[model samples]
Structure formats: structure tokens, C-alpha cells
Target: MKKANKLLKEIVVLIFALLFLSPIYIVFANSFKDRGELYESVLALPSSYSFQYYLQAMERMNFISAFGNSLVVTAVSIFFLVILSSMTAWMLARTNNKLSKIIFMSFIATMLIPFQTIMMPLIQFMDQIMRLTNIPMLNTHGGLIFMHIGFNSALSIFLYHGFITTIPKSLEEAATIDGCSKFMLFWKIVLPMLKPITVTVIILNVIQIWNDFLLPSLVLTSPGLRTIPLTTFYFFGQFTIQWNLAMAGLTLTLIPIVIFYLFAQKHIIKGIGEGAIK
Candidate 1:
């Protein structure tokens, strides 16, 4: 009876999984079909698969440039976020002072505030800073990356703080007794031990920053600086929508992140499991 119940549960979960994935499947299938076939039957298999829409979308969207811009922004933002958040969390974890506790709590508190509430004010502040300093904060990759770091740091710091607390302080003490400096101790001893949580942080931030649309849309105005999501808007127009082209563009945009997740999924799962245990 127990085995039967487990099997039945698995079957139910599988059904739900398929249901969740149906929209993605529909988009992928329709991407290969022409407009008429897509409109006629979205769920049906394409009568003949063709890459024409993909080719057209790629050309119209300037996929290569947009892809490069996204890669640069995501990579730079995650790099700084991981380094800064990890160090900040490590400090918070090791220090038991009231100030540290208050600061850590402050980071956690920011996570409760919705991004939508601050979106307009954030943009205005950036614009004001740009005007005051004569800096190109808007319509620039650096500006977008800076915003990503600010927005993503709270969660990253929280995750790192939780994981760092689980680590033994004796490890740092031992390193110190051997004459290792604080920086070296952290770099050689503590950071390596933080692999599991670090992987989780990287994967989470990568996906968030890479697929972000609204933030990028508000920050990036130049056509040359558009990300994949912004570039996909080319398929949309006032009078008519290029559904087939839009689908193809979406498929292309999804492929990179899907491939990245597939490659890193094992590490991600392992990190989460280990972090949970710790």
C-alpha cells in the first residue's frame, strides 16, 4: 500500500509538471511553424519544421549585439555581487556585535520591500545623479549592472550569512595562529568552504539578471545596449504582432539560460541540499 501510494504521488506530480511545461512546449513548437499554422493550431506539431522565423528574428533583433550586452552586464553584476555580498555576510557572521546584528537585519528588512514601490524613485534618483555628476548612468551597461548589484545584493547577503554561520570559527582561529592574514584566511580557508552556497548565489543571480526585462527597459535606452528581452520587442508593433517571429525570438532568448541551467543544475541542487543540512 505504501509503495502504491508513492507511485500514485509520483504520477500526480508528473502530470502537474507537464501541465506547467505546456506553455513552453507550445512556444517552442509554434516557433518552428509559420504564422498560419501557428494560428490554426498552436498545440499541434508543425507539419514541416522551418528555421526561417528564427533567422528573420535573429536579423531583426540583432541578436548577437544584444546577447553580448546581456552577457557583459550579467557577468559584471554577478561578479561584484558575489564578492561584496560574501565578504559582507562573512563579516556579519563572524562579528557578534549589536551593530553587526542590526546591519544584517537591515539587509533582511530591505528584502521585504517590493521593487515596484521604488522603481520610479530609483530611476529618478539615477537620473538626478547623472545630471549632477555629468555621468552616463542612464542608457549604459555599467549603470544597469550597478542597479542589478544593488537590487540583488540583499538576497545574496542573506543566503551567504545563513551559510557562513554554519561554518566553524575555529577554522579561522587556526589559520590566524599560523600567521595567515584576515584576507588570506578568508580567501584560502573560508571562501573555499563556501563553495556550496556560492554556487547557489551565482546560479540564482545569473538567472535573475539575465532574464530581467523591466529594469533593463527602464535603464537602457540605446538600441546598441539592449538585452535579449528588450531586443525581442522588435517583433511587437502597434497595428500587428509577429506572433511567429516573437515565439522564435523567445525561443532563442531562452536557449542560453536553459543551457546554462542544464550545465549547472547538479551543482545548484547539491548546493541547496548541502546548505540545508548545514
Candidate 2:
């Protein structure tokens, strides 16, 4: 009876896994096909695997430029988010006072507010700042990075705050006794110990910023500044969608983050688990 139950559970789990993976399979399999093949058999595996479509899409989309734009935005945003949030969380954790608590709570509270509600106002605010300072906020990569940092900071700080509190003050005390400055102590001792949660924060932000299309669409209007997701729009038009090239382009787009996530995925779980428990 127990064996039969176990077998049934396995079957059910396998069914769900297959259902989840079906879309990926379809996209990956169709990427090598042409329009006729895609139309004739959407689910059928390709007769021949070829890189021609990918090469064509890459040439048309200016894949290198689009890729560089995305890399710059995502990397720069994550860099600031990690450094600033880590420092902020450490300070908040170390300061034992009501004001610190209030500030920390404020960061947490901001996470509750949906971005959609304030997006219009945020754009207006950026425009106002741009007009005032003559800084290019709209139609620029800098603007998109600025927004990514703002939107992702709350969660990164939350994660860091939780994990920072778990760190023993004794370490900092010993470092201080050895003639370490506050900045050096954090850089040398505290930051090194934050590897687990740092990895978690990176994974989260990478996925968020890399995949985000709406905010980029709003902030960046120049064709030259288009990120990977924005470039995917080229494959789409008023009438017809180029499924073959679209699928290939999407496959290329997915490769970087997918490879990144697959490699660092275990760290994500590790970080979250450690942060939660300790």
C-alpha cells in the first residue's frame, strides 16, 4: 500500500514538472525552425538544428549593442544596490534606537507600495529633476539604472538587515581593537561574512532588473539604448510576428541569465535559508 502511494505521488509530481517545463521545451525546440516549420508543427522537434536564425536575429537586432546596454544597466544597478543597501542595513542593525527602527521600518514599508501606482508620478518627478538640473533622466541608460536601484533597494536592504543582525558584534569589536576604522571594518570583516545573503540579493536583483521591460520602456525611448527585452520588440510589429526569429532571439536573451541563475541558484537558497534561520 505504501509503495503504491509513493508511486502515485511520483507520477503526480512528474506531471506537474512536465507541465511547467513544456513552454521552455516549445520555445527552445522551435528556435531552430523556420516560419513554415513553426506553423506546421509548433510542438514538433526540428528536423535540423541550425544557428542561422540566431545569427540573422543577432545581426538585425544589433545583439552586441543591445546586450551591452542590458549588461551596463543590470551590473551598475546591482553594484549600487548591493553596496549602498549593505552599508545601510549594517548601520541600521548596529544602531540600537527608535529612530533606527523607524528608518528600517520605512524601508520595509516602501516595499508594500506597488510600483504601478507611483510610476507616472515618478516619471514626472524625474522629468522635473532633469529640467531643474539639466541631467538626462529620460531616454537614457542612467535613468533606467537609477530607477532599478530605487525599486530594488528595499528588498536588498531587508535581506541584508536580517542577515547583518545575525553577525556577532564581537567580530567588529575585535577589529576595532586592532585599530580598524568603521569603513575598513565593514569592508574587511563584515562584508566578507555577508557572502551568503549577498549572493541571494544579487540573484534576486539580477532576475528582476534583467527581465524588467515596463520601466525600461518608459525611461528609455532611444532605439540605440534598447536592452535585450526592448530589442525583442523589433521582432514584433503591427501585423505579423516573426516567430522563428523571435524564438531564437528570446533563446539568446534567456541564455545569459539562465546560465547565471543555474550556476548561482544554490547560493540563492543557501542565502535565504541562512538569513531566515540566523
Candidate 3:
């Protein structure tokens, strides 16, 4: 009976796994086919594999510039997000006071507010700031990254805060007695111990910032500043949609983050498990 139950559970899991992966199979399979072939049998495999559509999609998408924009935005945003949020979380975790609690709560509250509700006002406010100060807040990669950090900090801080609070205060106290400076205490002692949660924080934000579309769409007006998703949008026309090219574009867009997530995925699991264990 135990063996039969285990086998039944495996079968159920396999079913769900196949269901989850079906869209990926469809997209990748359809990407290699031409329009006529795609329309003829959407689910059927192509007669021959071809790189022609991929090359065309890359050309039309200005793949290099768009890819670079995405890399910069994601990398830069995550860099600051990790550093700033970790530090903020550490401080909040260490400081047992009403002010710190209030600040931490503020971060949590921001996460509760839906982005759709604030998006219009956010755009208007940024535009006004740009006009008033001429600091180029609305349309540049810098502005976009700044916004990413602001939007993402709460989760990063929340993760870091929970993990930090679990750490014994004795460690920081010992470091202080050892004549370690405040800066050194974090850099040399605390930050190193935060490796697990840090990796988790990084993977989560990388996924979020990399795939985000709406915020970037609102901020980036210049063609050169378009990210992968924005470039992929050109394949969709009101009248004439290029199914093959769109699929190829999607595959390209998915490749980097997919590879990244695959490699970093284990770390997320390990981190969570460790946090739970602690």
C-alpha cells in the first residue's frame, strides 16, 4: 500500500510538471517554424530546424542594445538593492526601538500598496522632478534603476531583517569588544554570515527586475533605452503579427534569465532551508 501510494503521488507530480512545461515546449517548437508551417499545424514539429527566424528577430529587435539595456538595468538595480537593503535591514534588526520598528513597518506597508494604483502618479511625479531639476529622472536608465531599487527594497530588507534577527547579538557584541569598527563589524563579520540570505535576496530581485515590463515601459521612451521585453513588443502588430519572430524573441529574452535562475535556483532553496533551520 505504501509503495502504491508513493507511485500515485509521483504520477500526479509528473502530470503537473508536464502541464507546466507544455507552453515552453510550444514556444520553442513554434519558434523554429515559418508562418505557413506554424499556421498549418501549431503543435506539429517543423520539417526542418532553422536559424533564419532567430537571426531576423535579433536584427529587427536591435538585440545587442536591448540586451545591454536589460543587463545594465537588472545588474545595477540588484547591486544597489542588495547593498542598501542589507545594510538597512541590519540596522533595523539591531536597533530595538520604536523608530526602527516604524521604519521597517513603512517598508512593509509600501509592499502592500499595488503598483497599478501608484503608477500614474509615479510617472507624473518623476516627470515633474525632471522638469524642475533637469536631473533627467524620467527617461534614463539611471532613473529606471533608481525606481527599481525603491520598489524592490522592501522585500530585500524584509528577507534580510528576518535572517539578521535570527543571528545572536553576541556576535556583534564580541566583534565590538575585539576593537572592530562599526563598518568592519558589518563588512568583516555580519555581511559574510549573510551569504545564504544574500544569495536568496539577489535571485529574487534579479528575477523580478529582469522580467518587469510595465515600469520600464513607462520610464523608457527612447528607442535605444528599450529592454528585451520592449524590443520583443515590435513583433506584435495590430494587424500582422509575426508569430515565428515573436516566439524567437521570447526565447532569446528567456535565455539569459532562465540560465541565471537555473544556476542560482539551488541557492534559493538552500538559503530558505537554512533560514528555516535557524
Candidate 4:
């Protein structure tokens, strides 16, 4: 009876998984179909698969440039987030002072506030800073990346803090006794030990920053600086509700992140599992 129940649960989960993935399957299938076939039947398999829509999407969206922009933004943002958040979290976790506790709590508090509430104010603030300093804060990749770091750092810091607390401080003491400086100790010992959580942080931030649309839309005005999501949106608009081309564009946009997730999925799962246990 237990085995039967387990089997039944597995079947149920499999059903739900397929149900969740059906939309993606539809998009992938329809991406290959022309407008005529898509209009006739979205659910049906394409009579003949063609890459014409993909080609059209690539050309219309300027996929290469958009992909490069997203890559640069996401890569730079994640790099800084990992370094800064990890160090901040480690300091907060190791220092058991009231101020550290309060600061860590503040970071956690910010996570409760919805991004939508601050979206307008954030844009305005950036604009004001740009006006005051005559700095290029809007319509620039650096500005977008900076915003991503600010918005995403809270969660990353929280995750790193939790993971850091689980690590033994005796190791740091041992390293100190051996004459290792704080900087060298953290770089050689603490940071390397944070591999699992770091992987999790990277995967999470990569997906969030790469697929971000609203933030990028608000920050990046230049057509040349658009990310994949923004480019895909403009492509959809230009195509005027052409579902085939739209789906093709979306499919192309999804390919890179999907590949990244596939590569890092094992580490993500492992990190989360260990974090939960810790």
C-alpha cells in the first residue's frame, strides 16, 4: 500500500509537471509553424517545421546585439552581487553586535517591500542623480546593472548570511593563528567554502536580471542598448500580433537562460537542499 501510494503520488506530480510545461511545448511547436498553421490550430503539430520565423525574429530583433547587452549586464551585476553580498553577509554573520543584527534585519525588511511600490520613485531618484551629477544613469547598461544590484542584493545577502552562519568560525581563528590576514583568510578560506551558496546566488540572479523586462524598459531608452526581453517586446510590437514570430522571438530569448539553468541546475538543487538542512 505504501509503495502504491508513492507510485500514485509520482504519477500525480508527473501530470502536474506536464500541465505546467504544456504552454512552453505549445510555444516551441508554434514557433516552427507559419501564421496560417498557427491560426488554424495552435495545438496541432506543425505540418512542416521551418526556421523562417526564427530567422525573421533574429533579423527584426537584432538578436545578437540584444543578447550581448543582456550578457554584459547580467554578468557584471552577478559578479558584483556575489562579491559584495558574500562579504557583507559574512561580516554580518560573524559579528554578533547589535548594529550588525539590526543591519541584517534591515536587509531582510527590504525584502518584504514590493518592488512595484518603489518603481516610480526609483526611476525618479536615478533621474535626479543623473541631473545633479551630470552622469549617464538612464539609457545605459551600467545604470541598468547598478539598479539590478541594488534591487537583487537584499535576497542574495540574506541567502549568503544564512549560509555563512552555518560555517564554523573556528576555521577563521585557526587561519588567524597561522598569520593569515583577514583579506587572505576570507579569499582563500571563507569564500571558497561558499561555493554551493554562491552557485545558487548566481543562478537566481542570472535568471532574474537576464529576463527582467520592466526595469530594463524603464532604464534603457536607446534601441542599441536593449536587452533580450526589451528587444523581444519591440519585435512583438513591430510584428503586430504575429503569434508565430512572437513565439519565435520568445523562444530565442529563452534559449540562453534555459541552457544556463540546465548547466547549473544540479548545483542549484544541491545548494537549496543543503541550505534547507543547515
Please report the candidate that would top lDDT against the real structure: 4
What are the lDDT scores of the predictions, listed in order? 0.87, 0.87, 0.87, 0.89
Which order, best to worst by lDDT? 4, 2, 1, 3
Worst 10 contiguous positions by lDDT, candidate 2: 233-242
TM-score of 4: 0.89
Worst 10 residues of 1 by lDDT: 232-241
- Any idea how many clashes model 3 has? 0
The local lDDT score (0 to 100) that residue 60 gets in candidate 3 is 81
Tens digit per residue, CA lDDT, model 2, 92-131: 9999999999999998999889889989999999999999
RMSD of each: 3.0, 2.7, 2.8, 2.8
- Model 1 per-residue lDDT tens digits across residues 1-278: 99999999999999999999999999899888887887798899999888998998888888999999989999999999988999999988998999999999998899889879989999999999999998888899989999999999988898899888877799899889999998998899988998878898888788789888999999988888999878876446421477777888889888997888788889867766654554
Displacement of the residue 107 alpha carbon in candidate 3, Å: 0.9
Q: Which stretches of model 2 miss by more than 4 angstroms? A: 1-16, 271-278
1-278 per-residue lDDT for model 4 (tens digits): 99999999999999999999998889999998877788899899889888998998899999999999989999999999999999999989988999999999998899889878989999999999999998888999989989999999898988999888877889999999999998998899999999978988887787689889999999999999999989988887788778888888888987987887688788867766664554
Identify the superior model by lDDT, candidate 3 or candidate 4: 4
Winner by TM-score between candidate 4 and candidate 2:
4
lDDT of 2: 0.87
Off by over 4 Å in 1: 1-16, 237-240, 269-278
